[model samples]
Target: MTTHDLPRLRPEVVLGPALRTGPKTVHHIKDESTGCFYRVGPREHFIMGLMDGRHTLQDIGVQYRETYDRTLGPDSWQQMFTLLGRYQLLDGHADAGVLDRFRQAQQDKQAARQGWLRRRWVLLQPDRLCATLAARLGFAFRTGFVVPALALIALLQTIVWTHTTVLAHDASHQRSWAVAVPLLLVLGWLITMLHELAHGVTCRHFGGSVTEIGLSWRFPLLTPYCRTDDIVLFHRRRARVGTAFAGVFVGLLSLAPVTLWWWLTRDGGPGHRIAAALLLFGSAGSLMSLLPFLRSDGYVMLTHALGLVDLRRESYRFWRLRLRRRDPAARDTLRAYPSGDVRAYTLYGIATLAVAVPAYCALMWVWFARLRHWTGPGWAVVVLAAETLVVAGLLLGAARGRRADRQAADA
Candidate 1:
């Protein structure tokens, strides 16, 4: 194409807000057609931003020169065009190479589908539902409602904390432990569904799409999830943060009625025992979601606030490189990132390891203790062996994921 020919980006392509990592500002470009996300630096973003079919290459070059006091040569222009074309980001037909790569990606995705043990069941497309809910429930996002709700939750939590001993006594004396436990589990699951919906509704309220609301099962764990990835495209950081916090907020809020019930019927009864147990379990779960070490609401909020993509992966990679100080190939890995990012990665890696190691150890100890009591010593040993195999499988999976991430970054 000639310099005067206009280049246009695909209409469905979405450009995310500028996210700063270290000294560089990066922008995310999502190709809705392919469901692929690409990150570009400020210069590429500037060039792509003008690809509206109205600005010719000459016009873009002129603007670029004016802004940065630099001119792009013919080769530079060709390279930029090639990169865009390879990703099929430009409007119109893609070349054979791009089509082949796209086909291969599709095949890879098919091959990588989860097995029966760890599966995802997409219940429904929740975009329309979320939009409707957001409209009707818009007032809930207002400060007038939020402030009082938070205060109520705080007060209820304080009451629960103060009456912990009495609640425990009631729970122990109750005759319906077996029935109440199962009922509490069911109630918790229902609240979890609402929690996912809350995330979708909040994203919709902030003008973001909630494409999927589904259940994901990874063996022993099955939970409802809402795909709020479109929140990244939002210009307002608070909107992104709010979307992340929505699930946890709804989870904690669900305890309000149960807390009230427990307070009113402090008399040692089955109903009161159930209510007390629900309060304790629900509160613990909600608070656990606020720990940044896990891929939970707190982690999501941290990433959004810091504008760092894949913080956990990056931190892990940083530590891996740091530990291999004698390896020449690994030495350059840390140098690629800016000093600020390197420091961030180092600190996060250390903090996560410090917390996660002790926490996991304690969890395993408790697991073994429980298993020993429930089963025999021999059966507990067998169960521990099975658990070890599961952990090994998880580590292998993580390794594969890291390799894939590195390949993507290189590309």
Candidate 2:
């Protein structure tokens, strides 16, 4: 099917929440705002069981003996539907289609307004911001910027990758040119081009034709990727590996001479030392390009090694598998093609959250704790409460979304 024909999601998938029950199946329903999904068995069971609407949840559970030949043994259905309704899945026992039009209208409004940007960024193949400038600057200017601009550009590189990854990914498919152009400019020109070029050059060197570059989405985030969809053009693992590592490799190799100069000239008087320091930081920036979890070159490298078409989706699928283990009777519907490194992606995700979220909290707690030692307990309590609330809101949004999504899918 053409892209549009391939189940362009109902507005509900975007504005409404989504409940995914399997790899390809998603049940979408309207929430007051945004969207959500669920992959939990208890939540799904509660939802599918209630959507039957034959009886009150309590009654259903009572006759659970009759329906499923098992005993839910309690009035959990009322509680379950109540909670689902609170999450905006079931609305106060109202008419079934009551809010359907309202939700659809909101989605239409959003699409009408936002679709311009989406179409520009996702449907049209546009030149990215940096492509012209980088082409103009050529190798000489790039070499000069390599020393002083690397660190600054390295920071820019991260932002560039974020934008370019999304833009280029879409552009590869003749989509998302508008989004790609702006993001490339915002990210600065040279690094973004380098990033895409890394993909193209590597693919070309590996005997794979670089058909296109554009923006794409990895669920919650956006990135640019090259269309080496013709990967089979080269059979050797090194070709594939090299193509994948090309971007980070370019980042590092581009900064190599400066790094050598810095090392060689470290003790060479005042000017030399300063130049060396700049070179050091610049090289360091190239190194940052290699980190995997933060959507840098490193992450793509891992995707290649694992041979998964999309690492993030596979990662989430793997995470969902853990949730599935909690409910054996419920089916696991998660899907990813060439599902390599699923466990690795799962562990990476877990370790990432474990390290990032708690570390951030603890760091803030300690900083505030020390400040409180001087400012008094009241200030400390206020800060702690504020932090707690922020975290709670984020977590609640996630949980409610997941629950709502599950209920809708089950329905």
Please provide TM-scores, in order, for all candidate models, with all chains considered together.
0.84, 0.42
Q: Cα deviation of 405 in candidate 1 (Å)? A: 6.7
Model 2, 183-296: lDDT tens digits are 435433355556667666556544344545666553344666565433432445455556666665565555445444434554443233333333344345556667666556
Candidate 2 residue spans exceeding 4 A from truth? 1-196, 203-240, 267-273, 329-342, 365-381, 384-411
Report the Cα lDDT for residue 165, model 2.
40
Candidate 1 segments exceeding 4 Å error:
1-4, 20-25, 92-111, 172-175, 268-270, 326-336, 367-390, 405-411
Best by TM-score: 1
Deviation of model 2 at 130, angstroms = 12
lDDT of 1 by residue, 248-324 (tens): 88888988888878877776544888887778778878888878865778888887877777678777767777899
Q: For all candidates, what are the clash counts?
A: 0, 34
lDDT of each: 0.80, 0.49
